[model samples]
Target: MTLDALKIPETPVCAAALEVAVAYCSPALLNHSVRAYIWAAAYGEAQGIAFDPELLYVGSMFHDIALMPEFDNHTAGFDVASGHVAWVFGAGAGWPVTRRRRLVEVVISHMLDSVDVAADPEGHLLERSTSMDISGRHMDDFSAPFKAEVLRRYPRLGIAEEFLACFRDQAVRKPDSSPAASLRDNIAERILANQLDRTG
Candidate 1:
């Protein structure tokens, strides 16, 4: 299925966020960001979850932005820094303070091991979807047909190597951060072994 087949949000905010991602993210990273949203929305539909598409779409776009050199932070974790960036983006998009904070929460929460879907459906979906895209975690949650179409439309483009390099660098610089913890937990192996890497 195409992205349009998934009914992706086409609001001004969604369009603007895509622009920002395209401007800053490498081609591989840009496709990964878009795939992140596609995965989340597809999973949400299959599960019958009611989530704010705009929040999830924008959060997915900015969730890994700190992986870029210009956005990387010296002290805070990449997820934390990315959260702040999304907050700023939300403000510029004319979102209220509460909504902006929710955006920040969704972006940062994607790094967590798990998020309560009832409390924050967008965060829950994003976390699960990023994990699905990166390490094939919870791959069974999506049907084989859906997974095939998503991969066909937005190929991984060797994100296995690209993302591992990003995380390895992050681990070196932010020894006390989440990426460091992930490396310690053998995330590199997981990324390399991801089932998606073997597909189209």
Candidate 2:
């Protein structure tokens, strides 16, 4: 159950991308990002699909970078801003245009409800894994043992509260944006949860 089969690309590239991601994201967000990679890779394995591990890793790591207030561009949705950051990073690293575009697509497309995995396999896998992590969507797709192991290695670290704040921040900054439209209702629920946790 090692992840070696995913065929991750060069060490330096992976290392560099991770370094940037870890530096930019909060601890909870960072943990969530890492878990996204593991879950996506595990899902790909179960499907007998071969993904570009480097693309999956880097894309997953920075997929939510735009949610960070410091990095928020305000001009676009969080997904598009995150994609732009990855695109710029890849371009500066001298990655081929096609590869860089695909990487950006992987990050941006995860926000969509459906993606053409045949055209962007990494994006589809990322979406599945992210949905599982964020909303518990498709929770039954993986077995108990697999879920236990992944969670054991990387605990949630209270990501829900932290991510909710980030989501709210984005929503507030642009009321007409996707984040605002989607997360408006959850604000009350999360607030109630925070209050109940405090009382308990």
Candidate 3:
């Protein structure tokens, strides 16, 4: 769905969260993160899934915060590390413990292959959107026109290459990390072809 049609939540806390996320992540990551939000919102609408706008927005913005130095937990996997970052950010924003718990799931589960949406729609939406953007795994659900409009509004600027590099470097630096264990195939294929895997 286009941004013009998507009802973006612009709560003060959401804006603040995104601003903090931008400050911590790379330009490519920032761009991809924002697109992840857009895609999540769009996918929710298409699937008739009800989601909290602010929750989805904040979760998507900081979903990969673990990759940044301030949020990185040297021993923790990227998923849990980023969840910790999101929890801290949410707490500072006056988010209640319940919401923070949900946000943690939303941010961390985005890396999972599939999620039980019945339990957490917000997390499921972010998971689908993250896959859609990072690997174009769900591009078929988003029509060509919609995809073009999104790209027009949010030019990739080599996000695929940059994000893959980040994932690769993370794997190298932390061999026991989640990315190394679960995403090695993606990095190897994308690196060899210089392309995001078109396959799901």
Judged by whole-model lDDT over C-alpha atoms, candidate 3 comes out at 0.80
Per-model clash counts, in order, read: 0, 0, 0
- Better model by TM-score, 2 or 3? 3
What are the clashing pairs of model 2? Answer: none
Reference-based lDDT, each prediction: 0.91, 0.78, 0.80
Per-residue lDDT for 1-200 in model 1, tens only?
44567887889999999999999998889989999999899889889999999999999999999999999999888899999999999999999999999999999999899999999999999999999899889979776777888888888888889999989888898899999999999988889999988765
Candidate 1, residue 42: the lDDT equals 85
Query: Model 3 segments beyond 4 Å from truth?
Result: 190-200
Clashes of 1: 0
- Tens digit of per-residue lDDT, candidate 3, span 13-103: 8889888977898877888888889988898898899889999999988888888777777778778888988898889999999999999
RMSD of each: 1.2, 4.1, 2.9
- For residue 91, what is the lDDT in candidate 1? 94
TM accuracy, model 2: 0.86
Stretches of candidate 2 above 4 Å error? 1-10, 184-200
Summing lDDT over every window of 10 consecutive residues in candidate 2, give the lowest-scoring window.
Answer: 191-200
lDDT-superior candidate, 1 or 3: 1
